[model samples]
Target: MGQRIFRRVSLGIMMCVLATGLVFAGSPLPNPPHKGEGILTVNIQGVFNAKVSLSPFKGLKTVEPIATVADVRGNKSAKIKIPAQYFPGEFLLRLDYRAKEADAPYPAERIIYINQQNIEITVNPPYINNDEKTKFNSGEKENTVFSAFMKENNAKRMPLDLLRQFLLSYDQPKSKLYTEGVKEFEQRRVEYNTWLANQAKIHSKLYVSRLFQFQYIPAIIWSGDAKERVNQILKNYFEGINFSDPLIIRSRELSRFMDGYMGLYGMQATTVALRDSLFTQAGSVACEKASKGDPQVYGWMVDYFYTGYESYDIKPGITMLQKHINNPDCFTSKKQQITQRLESMARLVPGALAPDFTMNDNIGKSFKFYQWKPQARNKLILFWTTTCSDCLKLVGELSEWYKQPANKKKLDIVAINLDEPEVKIGKWKAVIANLSSWKHLHAEEGVNSPIAREYAILSMPVMFLIGSKNNVIVSTPGTIEQLVKDLK
Candidate 1:
């Protein structure tokens, strides 16, 4: 009876080994069963003294794992059978087990992919130098594990695998990991862009035949900054190419994509430039073709152009938007918004009558631009501050001019200190102390003074000369020297 039992166990072990080898060999080929087709099977082997379980896949309900255990030569192995209907993408294969001895643990985890082609991944637990409890909590160790998994699996999968790893890394909640992943993704994007550019250049005509090239351009544009590097890349690729070129003609799709991308980011200049360039190249044919079927593209162009006009006073940009926004509803809404914003900007246009505003001087005396009368040939309301280097430089030049005999009687320089806090105004006072002939006033009310905002003061060292009628004679002259020249 012992002989009979021994023979039976030997036969079972042989059968299991044969089944495991066959399954492993067939896995990588594209022959996994689909619905109403052959059922896909997974047989796990080489596990010793551990419990194993398979989780139910959430995506495909019809797919289930069949669990079985067998004892061979005092060691145990687990087998799982997976059904068809699971998608071709990556799926997690989880294992759970505890070792009977404290020193010995299950040596490996396996990854299984089921589709027309079956893929298996074998993972070994990394060696931990410190205590097991500490190892579990080590972020560095966890990163190592993840990196190993990506490196091992990356060979089997192509670009998609790298993309998947990037997505996984980005999903990590920790900022450090997410930042690292983003950096890697950016590097990959740069490499891909370079590769695509090379391919297009080599097989210029052949590449344009594929419609996908159009889709690729917008992504390349989005990943990089609109700096010199990107500009050079685009110029090199598109220079000397006319609208008749197949790639140039096909680039209309890319232009549409850019319109949507820029609109989402609210980049007024880039959106307007791209749409205008496309319109010039494709003319009415492009618009009419897009209107007939690609409403999304048309709508993106329309919205981008309309918003561009509202954000800037570029006349050409406004004209482009006017041509595209012919639809009554869109035109009306966009027209109203643009008109309102334009009117607001028009009030700040240079060479116009400077707005009247009141501000308190350092001595608590209120001074109004329209009301103050200077005691020189011309009153120059030279807007400046102590903190501005350019303003200081201009003041040094003006001081030289004051020392000259010709300009002393002709120009009156009234300094307006826009700096805050009475203490911070010392720098301006100290600089002006030597030249007591010129008048200086500090706007004690800080930046909130109505005068500052009315003049649209953004930077320092601005100058506005008020004529006898209190009208602004010169607004934002090129430089101090230029202002003096203009006065002469």
Candidate 2:
């Protein structure tokens, strides 16, 4: 379980890395950008025509490069002018380079901390973090202190983690070795946490110091079963965390902290019902803890659980979020989304009238959803996109199902295309050409279209079964089998 926490931290960082997209600009560096903007000079070696980019971590989302310098040949440097809004935090420096002149460009990325100071770094792209191959300015404060802190912190934490593992796994609980192990574990945990706290205070003014509390090891009860131990961990997980400090969200470790917090509840569940119940309880506990702090943090907690609950179709968990979303002080950006979801849950349930919507069919015919009466008992409205693989799969299944005479007599399919950017409209035309038996309509603005908002279509492959009587939603079937089952 301790190991799981560490792994989640790494997973969080990797997720950030994977979601990031680097933008390349052909224009030269800014003459003088935002006031007090720092200068970052990157000297590349052993690669020709390298592209260097700099990005900063914002919230718990994908990162985009604020500046990029392309065509940086070997032994030459690229000067990237940092933007003022992104400073005083950790940034990712990425280098896309070719070892040989004709070889394809391979990318390498390294995390670098920046404040208001002008800093210069030289690196071999393939060996970006190699102490001998990469060098930072000797006068650099944030990265220098951070690099040293990582080494020292790891050294102090290694033995403590080892002792924890021993205490959890050791069979001879009645023996002196077990007792000695527990004592050593307690001693090391205290020493590590004490050092962690002091370091956090000592470097409180530095941007990197925001990450220290992530390393603060919490107390554990090694004397219980796994479930009991998880409960104890849940109780002590937020021991030293300061949720009131909004700056903590700028670090990737906060997501990792969230993962560990959520993972505890996940580890305890043996069935789907138990999982939903525990997750609902988890949301209540975690959100309550965050609600007492910064409004942004509180909103972040709500957004996190809302995403989880919606993705898992956890109605109980989603309902448990009403108080958090309704709180006036919570400043979550997802407020509109949560409100829409809650509204959707109430209005789109079985037997409720499906909202009327207008859309243009494939041949530019205006189609009003409620006015049309199909020659079937039910009308299945599918909100999908041509590019979605799942949507394509469901289309195939539905087409096959529709071929059966009895099934076709019972249900009519109307697929609402949510393809975006205008380019996908060509693909939509090509796709619907084959499914001539079904009605196809495109929402010009995709997910943001008014019809989509009315239906609360958060993701693709959403379906609503409308009865022929008054367009009331008969069922919201997830699969063709479910649709068949519901009709039966």
Candidate 3:
């Protein structure tokens, strides 16, 4: 019985030890931890005591100033607590603190922005002497001058230097200095263009032509003497090149560039002529070369011509395009679209007679091209405008066409001007005064002209062929060859 009692006592002791181990394992030991979020300790070491109050911005629930204190300590320092939630986006942290009576100014105001992080701003008193103020102003002026010189030099080293200068100067705070800088920059562009022109002439190279192709042509067009000089130089250069010579290929390529450049200059008719001439030459060369089995050269020639034709006129462009389409290795999906656009436009071809339409003239007098002359042969009515670059570009082509036997014997050409002011009509007349083979009419009523609206004239320099019966034949703009073919 004594041994059994001893075993019971041993079991009881084991249970007590097991319970103590479980309790120790379940509960963690105590550790010395960090206090409230973080503390902002402000140390004021100045001759004057400061009054400090910190207030949190609105919409922030957790952040608030713990307290306000007066006489914060002329020799001692203080601390303030800042909550973590106040640190993001844009918030105004206002500090209204006052200095001692003898200090420069009491309650110096500071506005701080809490943006993605905390900011520490330390306040210090300004110098109390006049000599320091004078030195500060003088140094500021020197720094300003140095900064301006650096900006100007840096801008000059960049592309579009003049534009950069203008933008930089314009963005400066409004002042006489900024305004003068802007005027100077404006004048600099004129000087630069003048220098560019002289260099172009001296090099006997088509600098403006090259510039027009690569850079912005509209700016050159709007520019003064550069436009006229560039146009004259291009014309002269074009006259010098022999179109039939193989060596003249580079010069012929210039014509493609001129096609686009002329459009920008409002020489629509001339642009078209240049484009057509280049493509015709290129296409003929490619076709001839392909026949000789020079597929590589032929392909290159085909691509060059195709690009020129695409930008100029997509309809008549199809004549040369058919050869490319027939070649299995040369045609692409884009070329397929060209074929489709041509077919769609072909439905408006000549011999169908012109569509009947009433259009008001510039003077508000309504007229009809179909009714102009009932007994006239097939009439070639060109719908164009004084402002149209493509229309002006077409004049050279028209002049060439007028010399052709088929066109001379079978058709009469008429030009319709769609310029706004009545005075602009006279201007248009003067512009094309040299072309005596065509009649000119102006629609001063602008886009409101009934004729332009009826045909859905979204693009300018459109041409129409009207048959002898005054029926619309082709509404699509055609080249001289296409027009002659239709006439035949």
> Whose lDDT is greatest here?
2
Candidate 3 per-residue lDDT over residues 60-139, each given as its tens digit: 22145544555566555455555554332122223333355664435543322222222233433222112222122222
TM-score: which candidate is best?
2
Query: What TM-score goes with each of the models?
Result: 0.35, 0.82, 0.31
Per residue, candidate 2 scores C-alpha lDDT tens digits across 205-249 of 676777777776666576777567667767766656777766666
Query: In model 2, which regions exceed 4 Å deviation?
Result: 1-35, 171-176, 326-328, 362-368, 371-376, 386-410, 425-438, 478-485
Let me know the TM-score candidate 1 reaches against the reference structure: 0.35
Off by over 4 Å in 1: 1-137, 140-345, 348-352, 357-360, 363-368, 421-423, 469-472
lDDT of 1: 0.43
Ordered by lDDT, highest first, the candidates read 2, 3, 1
Cα-based RMSD of the predictions, in order? 24.0, 7.2, 32.5
lDDT (Cα, tens digit) per residue for candidate 1, span 15-131: 111100000001122222345332222222233344443333321221344443322211333345445433332233444333333434443333333333333222222321212
Q: How many backbone clashes does candidate 3 have?
A: 30
